[model samples]
Target: MAKRIDVADLNIYYGETLAVQDVSMSIEPRSVTALIGPSGCGKSTFLRSLNRMHELIPKARVEGKVMVDGQDLYAPDVDPVAVRSQIGMVFQRPNPFPTMSIYDNVAAGIKLNAKRMRTSELDEIVERSLRQANLWDEVKDRLDKPGTGLSGGQQQRLCIARAIAVRPDVLLMDEPCSALDPISTQKIEDLITELKADYTIVIVTHNMQQAARVSDTTAFFNLRGIGQPGQLVEIGDTATIFSAPANKATEDYISGRFG
Candidate 1:
């Protein structure tokens, strides 16, 4: 089942320096939420914090609370690995395991989690996941080929299949379409709309129009000045944010006057 996220007084830091400051928001389950901002405003950093990916960096840490369906993700006994398994992530670039076949790429997470299954069971899951990602028809005949051999758009869909194969409750994407061509980007946008029925989707994008088209909720982040920590400027329904934002900064950004 999809799960809601509640983040309160969240602050992310790299060593002694704060990167994202005092962000609080509620993310609805089975909906798309877009995070938008200028370069270096911590939009990506904030996204990573949601799944505890930020702490992978040296000296990176988080303060305050992040709750998913009333379970505290930062609790002392909670395992980060478990948290990550339930919250999948896709990067800006399509990254398929270079050495693995298309079949193995989709099956990697399940195998890594030590879920023993017969070959037929694995095959069924790989097919179903590929169908869900809208890639089965394109690659069904070449499951033995290297995943990296597909076109850029096809590769991204394969990555999405891999992320969803484990049945994750939440999916995090950081510029998933930024590296693809227009045709590919449109395909991905369509796929995102289809996936939200089963997973909580959160994406960080620099393209304002893409955000407006794909998201149900939108959050804008900004910094006061260079080297300043980024903070949430405003968050609300996407329609209202695009049509009649209550914040002047949001208006300026959506109007193309400034970023």
Candidate 2:
């Protein structure tokens, strides 16, 4: 099931340097929220905090809370690995396990978590996930082929399939289409629209048009200057953020006046 996320006073840091500061937002379940900002503004850094992926960096940490379905993910007892299992992530590039077959790639997460499962059940999950990612029709006949063998777009969808195979409650996508062609980007956009019906999705995108097209809500981030921490400028309904943002900085950035 999809899960709601509430972040309060969230500050992400790498050792002594803060990257994103004082971000508080509630992400509705079964919806798409896009994070947009110029390069180095910390949109990706903030996204990484949702699933504790940020902490993978040396000396990285987060202050405040990230609540998923009312449970504090930062609690002492909460395991980051378990948190990641519940909140899956897709990266900027199409990184399918280059050495693994497409079917194995989709089944990887499930195998990592489940002690045992019937082959029939794993097969069913692989098929369902591929279909959900809209890649089944294109790759069904080649399930045993290397995932890297597919086109760039197909490989991305394969990554999406792998993410969903574990049935995560939330999906975090960090520039999932940044390297794709226009057609591939559109396909991923359409897939995001469909996926939100089943998973709470948060995407980071540099493309304003893609953000406008795929997201239900939008969060704009900005920095004061070089070496300054990124701050959330504004967040609201997508239409309002794009058409009538209340913050001048947001309006300026969206209007192409400045980043």
Candidate 3:
């Protein structure tokens, strides 16, 4: 099922410092939304807040409602763990478990979210998930090989396979292609385009071309002033933001005129 994310007057704080201010936007269901900005502009911070992952950091906190589907993720009695399970994340770097095999890495999510299953059922899930991630043909012959043994691209694919194995409604990717070569980056990029059919994807990217290539919509973030918090400068369809942004700040940033 496709799920929409609505951020209502969101603010984020790290201890005493306000990192992001009054950001609000709606993420369309089963579509790709790219968050783009310069370093320290709060794109990554805002993305983390979407899944409540920011709360995992010491002294990190957020205010306002982040609705996934129709439920408030931070509401009292709502399990953050359950919320996270429904929304999976892929990091800036490929982070598959070093000691685990490729097959084990993908199966890990299923095992955590679900109880024991028949061996046949487990095999099928692993196969399907890896294939969906476009890693099956590459890693199938080496299913028992350690995940770390694969190339950076393959390891990244394994991580993606792991994320989707649990059938998450939203997938948050934090620069998943930053560490890879162009060919490898293209694979992950293509996979992101394809996966939007079943998952709402939010990406935090420093690469504007990447955002343009994969996103249905784009949000440009910029810091308000020296030492001040970051804010959303503009949000619109990918074509509109790239070609004729309503905000001068967004237009300047995309055109390399300013940050």
Q: Model 2 over residues 76-191: C-alpha lDDT tens digits?
A: 99999999999999999999998899999999999999649899999999999999999999999999999999999999999999999999999999999999999999999999
Candidate 1 runs further than 4 Å off: none
The per-residue C-alpha lDDT of model 2 at residue 126 equals 98
Each prediction's Cα lDDT score? 0.96, 0.96, 0.92
Listed per model in order, the count of residue pairs whose N, CA or C atoms clash below 3 Å is 0, 0, 0
Q: Which regions of candidate 2 fall more than 4 Å away from where they truly are?
A: none
In candidate 3 the C-alpha lDDT for residue 89 amounts to: 96
Model 1, 209: alpha-carbon shift in Å? 0.9
Model 2 lDDT, full chain set: 0.96
lDDT string for model 1 (52-114, tens) is 999999999999899999999989999998889899999999999999999999999999999
